[model samples]
Target chain A: MSDKLPEKRKIKSAKKMRDIMTTYYLDAMTAKQNNRQVAWITSGGPVEPLVAMDIIPVYPENHGAMIGASKMGEDLCIKAEDMGYSSDLCSYARTDISCSIVKGGPLGGLPEPDMLICCNNICGTVLKWYEIQARYYNVPLFILDTPICHTQYSPEIARYVRTQMDEYIAFLETNTKKKFDYDKMARVGKLAYTAQLLWQKVLNTTAHKPSPMSAFDAFFFLALIVTLRGTQIAVDFYRQLLQEMEQRIQTGISMVPDEKYRLLWDNLPVWYRLKWLSEKFSGHNACLVADTYTSAWCGAIKYTDENNFLDSMAEAYTRIYLNIGVDQMADQVLDMIKFYDADGLVMHSNRSCKPYSFGQMDIMRIVREKTNIPVIMIEADMVDPRSFSQSQIETRIDAFMEIIKQRND
Target chain B: MNNKERGSIYAGIDIGSITAKAALIKDNRLLATHVILTGYDPINAGIKVFEALLKKAKISKKDVPAIVSTGYGRASVSFADKALTEIICHGTGAYFINPEIRGIIDVGGQDSKAILLNAKGQVENFAMNDKCAAGTGRFLEVMAKALEVELNQLGDFGLNADKPLKISSICTVFAESEVISMIAGQQKRENIIAGIHDSAAARVAILANKIKIKKPVMMTGGVAKNKGMVAALEKRLGLTLIVKDFAQENGAIGAAVLASKL
Candidate 1:
């Protein structure tokens, strides 16, 4: 008998891996199409938009992430660990190094970048992270500094970013040895804006009987738009997706195909354990009608006639989902409840990503206080599988549903 | 001649970042052992390991005498008769594995922690990298996707690393870009592999230095099994390490052994 055997997969895990890699491929395609000599991007949030830009964007997060998740981040995590970076530093950074040498690393994924662009909106960690990538990959790093947006982007801060953009565009042009076509930029921006508007419309469509789409649909939608932001096919696919969803809404069709307890999901999902969560939630007649992550993309601001493109871009980067703190996060979910006619909320208090995990207790309190909605906190991770205790999350969801049922009754 | 006359059983449980490990020793003879992921529910995973060890050894939970839990999630294990921090377990276990063992660096799913022990395996002090998931078990899981390989293959990959390229993404998010760039550069996979392991080793070595790494260094963790990491550490530190077969499980085994003493 041969030692070689079929790879054991729990279908969804395979899908997740595909999604992750597809995300990589889409970003690579963006670079290839732009005919740019170099492009740099981060893995989670930034890569998606860059992909839509038709410029090849590289994600530094993928490199060290696996090492941290696989009990190996420590080895790679040691250098910063030695410098007093603390074990609590992001695992992606640790494993990014791990992937570099632990065989088949970034060399195994995408190409070296000519330019690096990171935004400060997501977390304070980005500046340091990009700095690392700049040194390690030897690329000129650019910061899309949307100064800590308190409430919203002030005009002054917006202008500051616009100035940076001017420099950044110049740097990008020099690096690519290509001219910056304003027409192309404007066209791509409009297409992206259209995609955003449709996605918002599709999300709004969920208010009908059953949501016109499932969380699974939204997850795929995120990848397509985020990773393929700049392509016509990507835009068309989303437009088609919106049309299908609109039809479902008009026809009174449900995304789950069954009218269950309409619910709201909040925070980054336990990426590795999403299927288990979705399956577990689905079994209880509870379908997630809206997640803040999906909704966050729906309302993306677009600049056209009167709006300055750079200002709009600056606002978009600063106004990311996790940028705002708890009260705003609660308000977003509250809006979803009314829009999706949701019955309850599920909040994932991820141990790995603590920034997103903040004020959930307060958010839960407020949600209960404001709309009288039932809220449950599922302790899990967006990427790492170990943080997901299926039983714990399952039990919590079951209990949360019972609470909802009792409340509804 | 008291409990020794009747025969004593020592069980060690090492709760790790990614997996929980256990070992049972009846006097001098090794009884049985097992490894299981801590999963999302550390309590459940720990208890499951407990049940597994009993079933595997064909001994009732009562016969185990005492059990101990140690690791990132050590405090969360309710089933353990007692809980010892991974620092204590790793130091003690390292000493037991080798009488000369002085420092133990252990990494797990969401944390990278190093333990320093006196000659007697008692912890003098320790340093841990915990705030972020970098330099932990989760790091490997995320990086494997970029490398497109199994976590276990990290050792072989690092060993093959010839052209060590410096990896920049210490934060997992940016690292993705770093890896993607490496891939696009058409660089050899082995060179990138060396860069990753060496950088990871640098992280652990930093912790070693904080404790002031001593001779006859022994490393135990899931990473200890990776040929690339061990080899890289050997090259970096200029000392050979004694890695146990169940390096990852050593904490659990150590915990169990500590349980019997209590």
Candidate 2:
């Protein structure tokens, strides 16, 4: 190894981020003693309402990611399979389902939810997943159905989702036994919007020649936007993180030293192998400057109106990345490629995520035809380590980097 | 440390899952090549194959100034100057052999790949089989064992087939059961062998078509030696494959070509 220490390249904000996440989980774990209601919501669900209601918003998908990063996914996934779930089911759902029974995640298990909020905008799997959890906990469940915007978001679709916004507030009122606070929601909505913009700015820092942070860092920092959005905590945390990124850029502290080839990643990260993958790319002087996954938390910001957060959110949440057409998704990807000036694209054909992975082939072809960059698809699961093939993936990445190097040379 | 001062000879070692291969070159011409079963110890196999190749080429190890390694066990060759992926090596090797070759379908012991090359012999694009052994050399090896026929004789037996049967399963284990059922039904051995080739061809053809493989394609790797599999692939892909004398040793040859540049 070089004399330059590994810790020298690490983001100093990481320790602070970890502390915040630990505190957040601790508060949620003791929600009962604090007389706080916990609402387990989907990652793509509108969490601002729950935030405004003073209910601790817990995310099972976030918990799934934690299990994956801690390398507890394989055993939990096997347990779910033993419980008669198909091996092909989403690993997040499987891990969450099994973690409920075994209490076997990084945190023993997530605190029991007083209510559940399910949104189908991200995937159809969440509907069934949340339904199963609702039955398991015997709690109230609210489902928000968003029509897929294959071409354009229509008024009819907007109306349907907007009505659910009212029902969502009513559901929170019924479950928490408190009236909906519109003023608090307005403030939360603005904070959520501000956090997303800051998060986007943080992600865009990678557009610098020597990216201050890699997508791997983004994956770590993404937890706040996903879990603590709509809170001053998330907004304040991102502002500080963004300032650190700008400082790193001013000081020329690149995540990958001697950064040469910049690549863009698609789909969820192989959470368990993030470090391995980071070092592998870094070995080639390649930095994964940006990714579609982390940016997803901020991708639909153009549709949001902070001044009128409630009404515009219906459209914003409905037309998010995974809910749109493949062609539209490809368009967004192409835009990102140009913005980031990426040399290559690495697509993860995740086995567990059907929506994210399904149209990837079409997107890959589109990128190939539109841009003169090399694209490689790695078949793997985000959480389930058993589906990962180390040697095969290594060969593919090496070969892909070779081609990129040749083209750039 | 100048390669020219050290005799201007380059060496390459490719340690695959099932076999170890070595090749040597001097002044842009291939000197010698060697192959042996990789077995369990790839590090030992890599050394043995390289030493055997040097002996065959009448050169000492120190004379070969630059060495490159490729394939699955590429990193096992600790002596190599650089380790490159087989995709680039194969492309460079095929282009060195024939500049007209624009695409390559390499079906190795455990993996199948279709690579597209630019006019300069650089890999433009490529695709590999997923985490499965459905269309690789090992797939045919398993079928040969199930049919109780010698691996080398599979081509002749398949070529004699009057009507090729169709094997439906894309999985190796499931396909073996399909073959057993055909054997129980009294299907001819030659026909069963032909069916097996067709199944493997169909699977490999998908990789070729996925990258839209270009014309004048070259076939490499151990599976290229099977005439029946070649014919099936030709029929399925609607293009003839260029298989030369060094087909099985192509990866090693490519690695050697890259070593000279190092």
Candidate 3:
């Protein structure tokens, strides 16, 4: 098995991605100097309008991921707790809030916001989190309330969210003191749709045996889609990434060296332990072929219309994976398991993200009952390494792999 | 043991938080076992227990071909050929002792868990206590200290309780204070001990029920020696637990068994 280990192949797109992201962050950092406006937006919030208005969109959630990946989450989280923010708040929220005051994250904190975009489509916590940040930063705020779509996207729900979308545009205009640009938004929305499709295609490439890439790679590549979704750069980067994946598939290059077992991940990753978790699974000759978390960028793509981007944006954003009911979440998870030919499911019961982690147990049970494949639930915080227990998770992974091996054999 | 039989010996060492246990197996038979306080250093404890077992079996260290370590301190044993998680070790150990065991409920010094096993003896599913000592032996130790009773006496005293008091605090520190207040309120020692056992058992049972634990469950780990805990867990789970004489050494025994295969 060791002899059959695939040679380490670096994705050529990673270097380019770094350059693009560096440029993006640098632009945000110097936005004030350049007389450009910066709008802090939730990861799931509509960024096309902001892009169309020439307002550079910044994601505190993305910054939180950076803080976590750099292992600076604990200090920022502690700082938030010291400032009377509950430790129970999302680590991303805690880090963002604390990092803003301390200038403590990797990039010495995000640039100040001219306005804030709060979307309740991701979770209810974001509403309060954004409100607190808005108060602190003294920025104009736009709140997009997308009701939970339990079963279907009703017309009433559409009308309610669409009204908010119009209000969102007006709010943007008020802050910018300029007329809204419909043509630019149309182009931006089309670019966002293309990027989402390309991302979905890149992820689908893992459906092949001995997957060309793993969810760890997706977690890294996910930054572009979240931060610059409505930009030509994101679409072009993903197109190159998808091509790279296609080339890997053609060359029989595999992420998991042996790739005897394939597992699907659910929920936000333990950001601090991404490499450890990846290697742990790879050591067992198992590849995390797909994940519900990363696929979320493209999960609602079916609702998106490239041509009618603004009109369809309401449904596409509202019916995202986090905003849907547990049953729908389970259905999507089951579909991924079948689509990826997964042998087991590994669910992270994240302590930070409640909306993503809350329905995991039901999803786990649903997948097990429907597919009879084993599901492993690990309790962890996506950002805060303090919440993770290396020994305990190691044991769970080893035992889970043992079970998978037994059934496969 | 004959020299030829001893040459095939495999050793398993389990360095738990409180105690270090070692088991030696030769020709698929339990040759010798040792248990000792792990103290502040697990590495020394692993070496002491392993060396002690080797002397008791009257064999040289070179006679053993493989050594497997388990438990929380498993990684500290640098001499171990392989280290396995206590979950797999416990399940493997339990199944080796009783082939019919479909589940394992292990309550060690600091942690408690329920492990479900398939017919092939592989671990199917498991649930563990959070990063707390509420459902573990440490919880009982704290209760015993609060009750002013010996740890070993807790089992018999609880068995004599007419009506056990209710312990509602899930946090170990709070539960200790609750027990102290109950003593101040003139609660019977037996009743308080029984209440403590009941609460701990109830917490452990949640783990079992969470995973839909299977039947013929075997109880292992240091806490299993306390008859009161086993009884309380059995009552909560409504299943008779299979407790072997070497229940506390089960993980070590399983480690030794795996070493044999290695």
Candidate 4:
């Protein structure tokens, strides 16, 4: 992070090449000129803060996730394993590698990451994932060390992240040959925060009877927000989106209408198991009204002031996902259930996502005690299709539904 | 007393996370069964279900020769004379109920499980999804609640769907979203319901597919009562499902059957 600029923008040509490559996801959508560059905003690591900087984001994790679902997970995993990457490491790592190799991807096939940022928040897999990309297409890699906190984040960790974030801006300025404008960024930060506030407001809109938003819709919003958090366009986009939801709420239009039993879902979904989950309950006329992930990510607040944006960005950017606390997680989920007017609860006992799925039983008990709501614990994994069993989960759901109906009666 | 008059009364408690079910067997014949909500406390729920069963049978706990327990919270019940795995109990119970049953699909509220049994109804291979409610009793409960229908009526609604939806994801969160999308598309409620039933059937098919599903899949747990889901599943696999009359209490009955064997 020295104040040295390369003789020629080493990445200028490379960024253009990557944009030309990634224009696939804009399928059936608006076509853009070369002025519209694609960005990859990597998940779990130093991503949200990068928006504060004026570079388009490119997330490598989403690419990896796509690879994980395709035929490439085992192949990439074998390659990584051959290189001594342990099998015990998350499959997401292998999936990212596969994504790099596979020609197939979402959003017109994702663009190759221009600048890579790695944070310790999601874990070491990201460091390795970014390292592979940085070497593959030579680029500047910035690593942000989010010091783990016990009770509250130690100031030292905050200092470390602040220093890294400062260097990131310097790198962007030098590479772009643009002078750092604190005022412009601060204005953008304020705009970004407004967008975030609107997004949060949209999520809170579920408080309306027959919520205008659903967890599925939130995932889409997350996709947009993650990619466009710090931009004015994002603020406008969210403002319009919130307005639409406001209309829905005003009209009492339910995302899924004819609501009978409302339920709060916990933890990450078993991706391979989603089809079965929807049909089983929808067949029975039940809808999962809310979940921990949608609520948590949907509530992400943006900090718009760049002058002292360090604390706000750090707090919002490195949220509960960055800070692991089971009790805090449980409380947030419990609060969301009531907010959604949910009648029951679902806790996914995922084997893959231990960081998210652990303490599910304890959380279930607490939710039941506090809300007197029926809590159903179903087992599955985040990505690995092998970990899910459909029948046992159905049996458990059947019992929970009976309780709901009985209670309603 | 005559030598043929000795018919031991056996009680089995299946203390699952979502529900506590109890079964009473006298002289190898089913006497009574009860299934009740776990409500916050599994142990107390187990006791309540057991008391309710005894009351239904008009008999005291003293008359029972032995009591056994099974399920996630089975070990927590101090009153049970012995504890058995839900696996062992389910196999025994399925075999006793229908000797032709080769597979036991026991879906509970908190979890969903697939247990493979031999001719003897002993567990040979088993797979369980105790991690999520995507394909279990809890899933159906949510859907039924959404429909404003009783749990008992879910199967009927599913059967009437003129078209069935293909729910693409198994995660409950995504499933709900998928349902919303289907509803947004102005799909029929019955078709949506049928589609949901297929989703559960597909999940069960995954577990049942793992091992050799010879014949006569004994679909149990609260989900078995849904004729829509079970029938839809039957049409999908081109095989008939043997749903027990009191599938909700099968786990506890399985435990009692295992107790009788022990």
Interface RMSD of each: 16.1, 0.4, 1.8, 11.7
lDDT of 4 by residue, A1-409 (tens): 1102232212122343234324534421232344433334456543444454455566655554445444344555566567676665566665555445554434333555556677666555566667887887677777766654435656776676677777867766665566767666666666656666777776777667665655545544555455555666667666777777777666556655455777777776555455567666655557676677754443445322445554466655555443556676677777787678888887777554555665676777678678877676776656555555654565566546745664675
Query: Which one wins by lDDT: 2 or 4?
Result: 2
lDDT string, candidate 2, A35-111, tens digits: 99999999999999999999999999999999999999999999999999999999999999999999999999999
Candidate 1 regions exceeding 4 Å error are A1-36, A43-54, A60-87, A91-95, A103-107, A249-253, A302-308, B1-262
TM-score of each: 0.54, 0.99, 0.96, 0.56
In angstroms, give how far residue B236 of model 3 lies from its true place: 1.3
Q: TM-score ranking from best to worst?
A: 2, 3, 4, 1
Model 3 local distance difference test score: 0.91
- DockQ (Cα-based) per candidate? 0.02, 0.95, 0.56, 0.06
Best by DockQ: 2
Best by lDDT: 2
Sort by DockQ, best first: 2, 3, 4, 1
How do all the candidates rank in terms of lDDT, highest first?
2, 3, 4, 1
Clashing pairs in 3: none
lDDT of 3 by residue, B146-176 (tens): 7879988899999889999999999999999
Q: Please, what are the lDDT tens digits per residue for candidate 3 over residues A102-214?
A: 99989998999999999989999988988998999998888999999999999999999999989999999999999999999999999999999999999999999989899
